[model samples]
Target: MKHKIALITGSTSGIGLGIAEAFAAKGYNIIFNGLEENGSEIARKVAGQHQVDFLFSGANMLQPEALREMVAQGTEKFGSIDVLINNAGIQHVAAIEDFPEEKWNAIIGINLTAAFHLTKAVWPNMKAQKFGRIINIASAHGLFASEFKSAYVAAKHGIVGFTKTAALEGAPYNITANAICPGYVKTPLVEKQIADQAKAHNLPENEVVKKVILAKQAVKDFVPVSTIAELALFLASENATTLTGAALPVDGGWSAQ
Candidate 1:
């Protein structure tokens, strides 16, 4: 009964999946959201393995009503949601002029605006409880820039700004908010980006990895999903009360450069 509930978006795959497993392993009941067709099964398997409670929602990030409904359902089932992780995101790589308007809109809608909607939906419950944690999964691009990724970078930068504002508003209510800026992780999304980058730069995929994909990171390795998950666990802990309103980088020294 003392266990808390955590609602994580995009939990069916990639970094979100890793984080969900971590939370469940810690006995945090999970509300998982993702667009993947098998998202429910994935959520169930993880929760079952960890012996934790869970609910799965196939809510598209662009749909505000659906996101709020998911929150309401989770709260109804769990009594209250203790944490929210805005981890669902999409990306596209193209020069500013060549970037499709529709692509830009979708990127901003899914990556940036969706976080706002989810946070707002969860705010009243957290405020009443006087305890909450909000974690935004931003990117290394949030701290810097890369050519041919205008929409993705812009949206991630927006996420960082949104995190700060949420932190300020949630301060009095003990609802801490922070953004995690990660270097590239070898997710399906990153794999797609690598392919796109290879084509864009007219280089072999291996060369693109060394020269373009990993060029910014001094460590020259993908950031581990587990590392990001661990930091999120820390931020969601009671000990992290004083750690709000910051964009902590987990970008393998990419941000240092």
Candidate 2:
């Protein structure tokens, strides 16, 4: 991937940042996206660290036009995109009776529909170049349902189906599409979920984390960011061209059960 350009969405922090760092470590020029200004700064730093060209774009993925513009701007700067990681997503949990309609819309718009739009926008470019790697950061929730996380589960499941269909379509073009489904990863996003669980269960953070998040996993431990990052790196590499349409689970045996 040494002169190839990869675009990873929502890369300011968390799993997206991990994937970006992994790609940078492999000498791939990266186009980083986030709604925050800090994303660009981080891209500059990572590019410098890796000694590769880096591009940044700030766009709210919820808007279709913004998503298109983000891809356009990145391509204008980087020439062509060789890989795309659709890693931008949000999570909201609430009982069916109390779930906010707006929250549902926001979660689906960002987590599911945004990937669709971005992939559509990049499809022609990948086809034209006759090469692409598309990886979506789904979750264990995608394969298993959890109470009070209706929208998140639905969106992720949708992503898995979307990934398989995309993989089939891109196969003829030599483009590979896959999804990475992970369990509890200790990112700030999952940290927020732990905090919310603690408050809702009226338990200490540790107990809430142990009994709620890690208890379901066979290994019963939080997955490291490096695990997911390495998975993304493998999917982005030339060796993985044959490994498309897979919803690979990196959930410490959570989904295996």
Candidate 3:
């Protein structure tokens, strides 16, 4: 039997890479997309470790043409992309009045609009095959608001709404769409946010983490990337057909508050 393929963006490191390894271990071929220079090597390592077929693309999420070409290339190689994870994202933290116009545009473009383009690109093959898993990596801010994250918050909320719309439209086609909203995960992105939050709140990095970052999280620990990856696997499972349109939170009780 042919292996199902998963195309995950920004997967060279962090959460996306974790999910890639999990699916590869389950014998799924992978299409890895990221901007990291050693992404091909990283992809090769995971594929070798799991003995699965794989492809790597360093496509920029801000470029729709590049993203479309990526999907086309993966489809042509793997027959069909069975799972699509819209995981590429960038963030900037600043007050709305201080936020640069360029930053706003880039955030919205890469975070929210890229998901639309990729979903649209994969629609035909998924509709034809009648099996597709669209898992979006949204943030806790998708469900709640925070200061100095106007663009990121807006884009995440937009993606959550988009997930619901896709879920509704794909219900009849055996395609499922869902979003995973995570709290503070200590990835490079969040590391940068730690510094940004420190500056924004005029506190030390450690203080910012305790008083601002994890303040709303009932659990003081960071959400594990492995947990998020496992959830993504379940969402992509054949049994997950009925679990569509939900923005599931693995935020260490941050969502509970």
* Backbone collision tally, model 1: 0
Worst 10 residues of 2 by lDDT: 194-203
- How do the residues 123-145 of candidate 1 rate in per-residue lDDT, one tens digit apiece? 99999999999999999889898
For 1-257, candidate 3 gives per-residue lDDT tens digits of 88999999989998899999999999999999999999999999999999999999999998999999999999999889999999989999999999999999999999999999999999999999999999999999999999999999999999999999999999999999999999989899999999999999999998988899899999998999999999999999999999999999889899886
lDDT score, candidate 1, position 93: 84
In model 1, which runs have C-alpha deviations exceeding 4 angstroms? none
Q: Count the backbone clashes (under 3 Å) in each candidate.
A: 0, 0, 0
Q: Which runs in model 2 stand beyond 4 Å of their true positions?
A: none
Candidate 3 TM-score, true structure as reference = 0.99
Model 3, CA-based lDDT: 0.95
Predictions: Cα RMSD each: 0.7, 1.3, 0.7
> How big is the RMSD of model 2?
1.3
Candidate of highest lDDT: 3
lDDT of 2 by residue, 1-257 (tens): 33888889998898898888888988888888887757778989988998988888888888899889988987888888888899988876668788899999998999999999999999999999899988999999889998878999999999999999999999999999999999999887788888777766678997987798888899978889899999888898889989999999988899778
TM-score for each predicted model, relative to the true structure: 0.99, 0.96, 0.99
Ranking by lDDT: 3, 1, 2
